[model samples]
Target: MRTQVAIIGSGPSGLLLGQLLATVGIETILLDRVSPEYILGRIRAGVLEDGAVRLLDQAGAGARLHAEGLIHDGFSLAFSGQDHRIDLHGLTGGKRVTVYGQTEVTRDLMAGRAQSGALSIYEAEAVTLHDFDRDAPYVTYQKDGQTHRIDCDFIAGCDGFHGVSRKSVPETALRTFEKIYPFGWLGLLAEVAPVSPELIYAHHPRGFALCSMRSMTRSRYYIQCSVDETVDAWSDERFWDELRRRLPAHHAEALRTAPSFEKSIAPLRSFVTEPMRFGRLFLVGDAAHIVPPTGAKGLNLAASDVHYLFEGLREQYRDGSGAGLEAYSAKALARIWKAERFSWWMTSVLHRFPTMGDFDQRMQEAELAYLAQSQAASTALAENYVGLPF
Candidate 1:
């Protein structure tokens, strides 16, 4: 099969790219390793930054999101037994975040593509990429135990950190950077009510605990643990006991451990690959960069990549130019590095360090205290959290 573009991974990045391209009458083929529904069924990040929501709306992908997604004007930082609220809307003008899951976003993108009768294939594993320097680069993969090849004008590698597209790039052209945290988050979604009105980032003597949500009926929560810890090590009784300690007593229902629908430990890390574009193969989303969930920038950054890439492609097709493609890597990297810095900053400041001395712990407390007391510090945090400017 042949297309103007071949997108690997049907996640939000790939699906959104295909949808954007199709709107411009650009033919695209989207491939993924799992069934579309299966990919959409997984639980992931649920915060949508202002720029991300607008991009979705502009691409005609925000019907369901606008209808069902919750809009939050602010978030609270809880520490020292007091709450400091950052007015996201007030600080960033009208920019507000929406409470929408990544899975839902992917579903909307896929449904939108299907309505247009676009080519999207699931259960397709990319074996390798070839001829990236040529006009017609292609990807080889297997489907239903049968080998297949797809030729395309360009390849967008959105399959994520473990996918084959990254490896296809010559090692000499790659410069990798990463920082793995000593702790991971044990996140869970329960059938209980939310403890706070909006998301809460709390720093306690025990560790860092976050209060978030999936919907009105389902509450999402996270607790910091050792990177090697397993969910099995945390029993229901233990989970509730720790929750009671970390969460304020004002939290409803004595914090019973509701039946957990989803449980996973995501190790905290910051990762990036220089020059996101390599010839005709362009990497986006997790395939190119990763951010700790602290700032909720992962999905938003991926959406930004697709937005820029689509813009660049239009320029290339318009004036018969190569400048846009040449500049794609640097442009995308600028935003990627900014988000990476914010995520790293938030993670380092909010999370408790195990090796902290008295002075170090005092410094962390002082920083939190300053943010809680000063409007300037609060606004800085609010701007970064609400979403960096496009």
Candidate 2:
């Protein structure tokens, strides 16, 4: 089989790219190692930046999102027994974020792709890229006890961190930078109303905690835990107690607890791979970068990467110009680094470092105090939270 682009990994990044490319009549075949059910079963962060929301609309997948997703004008930063509202809408001149689960986004995109009559190969085993460095790149994979090959003009490596996309490149050609945090987030999802209407990032003497949601009736909460902590060690009662301790008294009083249906512990890390493009192969989303969820930039970062790469691909097919493709890596990385800095800064300010002394603790407090009183600092946070220009 032959196509204009062969996309590996049918996650949101891959699916979104495929949908957008299809808008311009670009032929793309999506290959994934797992079934669609397994893909949607994986829970993830939900905060959607305005730019990301717009991209979904451009891809014809924003209808359900705009209808069911919660719109938040701002989120609260709770510290020192007080909640400070950032007023995202006011600070960013009326820009806001949408609180929609990543699962829903994927579902909508998948449905849109199906409706468009595009091709998606699920449970494709041993998927491999070939000759991406040469002019005629292709992909091969196993299915139904047979090996198949697909010739393509370009390959998109949206297969994520552990996938073959990044590993396909020679180590000598890649430079990687990573920082693994000392703590992980123990997150819980329960069927209950959220403690606050807007999300809350709380810093307390014990640890860092966040009050978030997937919908008005469904609450998602998290608290910092040791890197070595096990999910099995946390029961519903214990998790609720710890979370209540970390929140302010008023919110604590209003908090509603229920049996959690989903629970997990995810280690925090900041990782980025330089030069997202390799010959005819371009790495998008988790394939190129990862950030701590503190600033809620992970999914949005992936969307922006899609935006840049799609533009390049569109220009390549529409106008027969290679300039946009040539500039993809440099341009994507510029915005990526700024997001990395913000995520790192937010993580640093909120979480308690293992080695933090008295002075370090006071500095964290001082930072929040100044941010609450300073409009400039608040605006900066709001701009990053709502997302920077794509």
Candidate 3:
């Protein structure tokens, strides 16, 4: 098979890139290691930044999102028995975030791609990327116990953290920066109503508790846990008890519990690979970077990468120049670093640091108190929460 671009993942990043490139008469074939239903079964991010929503709409992939996605104008920070609401829409001049899972986004994009009659190879595992230095690069893969080769003008690595794309780059051409947190998130989804109208980030004596949702009938919550905590260590009763201890009980009457549909743990970390490009092979989304989900920046950051990458490609071909690819590293890094800083800051504020001394903890509490009482501090958080411009 031959195409203009070969995208090595069928997740939102790769799917969205194919949709965007198709607008400019560029054809792409997306290869994924898993089936669409399996990919959609993995529960991930739930917040959609304003810019990300706009891009989806522009690509004609936001109809279901706009209809069913919940919009929130603000979120509350609860600490020391106080609730401080940061008006995101007010701070950002009407820009707000939407509550939509990454899984749903994948489903939507896949449907759109199928409707457009685009070429996508599901359940194809990318084996290697060859000849990326030449004008036409080729990617070899195995599907259904058979090997196939795909030739393309360029290659995009949109696979996750464990994929082969990052390793495909020569070690001498790679530079990496990363930080792993001492704690991870124990995420739970139950068939119950949400406890609050908007999301809440609570800091309590026990640990951090987050109140979020997937829909009006389903509640999604998270609590800070040791990075090594196993899911088998907790029962349904213990999970509820921990949630009650850390989460505010103001709406206890409204909160209901049903059998869990999904439960999992995610480690907290920040990662970024420099340059993000090497000749005809480029890395996008989790393949090039990762951030703790505290700031809900993962999916949006990935969308930002694909958008800029495609814009660069268009400029390259349209103007008969290579300047866009040359500048891809600096431009994408600027946004990536800002998001990394924000995610780190939010994670530190909510989670208990194992290495924190008494003085450091006290200072952190003092800062939280100030943020609740001071307008300037709250505005700063509001700005970051609503998202800084890409």
> Among these predicted structures, which one has the highest TM-score?
2
10 residues in a row with least lDDT, candidate 2? 381-390
lDDT, candidate 3, equals 0.86
lDDT of 2: 0.96
lDDT of 3 by residue, 108-146 (tens): 999889999998888876578998977779999998788
Provide the TM-score for each candidate, comma-separated. Answer: 0.96, 0.99, 0.97
lDDT of 1 by residue, 1-390 (tens): 888899988889998888888878789988888887688777898799877888788778999999989899998877777778888898878778999988889888888998989888888764678999787798888988889999988999999999878988989999999998999998888897777769988877788888888777788888888888999998766766776677555652435458887888899999999989988999999999999999999999998898889888877777778788888899899989999999998888778778877787788789999998888998888888887776
Q: Of the candidates numbered 2 and 3, which has the greater lDDT value?
A: 2
Runs of candidate 1 exceeding 4 Å displacement: 252-257
lDDT digits (tens) for residues 1-390 of candidate 2: 999999999999999999999999999999999999999999999999999999999999999999999999999999999999999999999999999999999999999999999999999999989999999999999999999999999999999999889999989889999999999999999999999999999998899999999999999999999999999999999999999999999999999999999999999999999889999999999999999999999999999999999999999998999999999999999999999999999999999999999999999999999999999999999998899897
Alpha carbon lDDT at 244, candidate 2: 92
Error of 3 at 256 (Å): 2.5
Ranking by TM-score: 2, 3, 1
Q: Which residues of candidate 2, in runs, are more than 4 Å off?
A: none
Ten contiguous residues with the weakest lDDT in model 3? 247-256
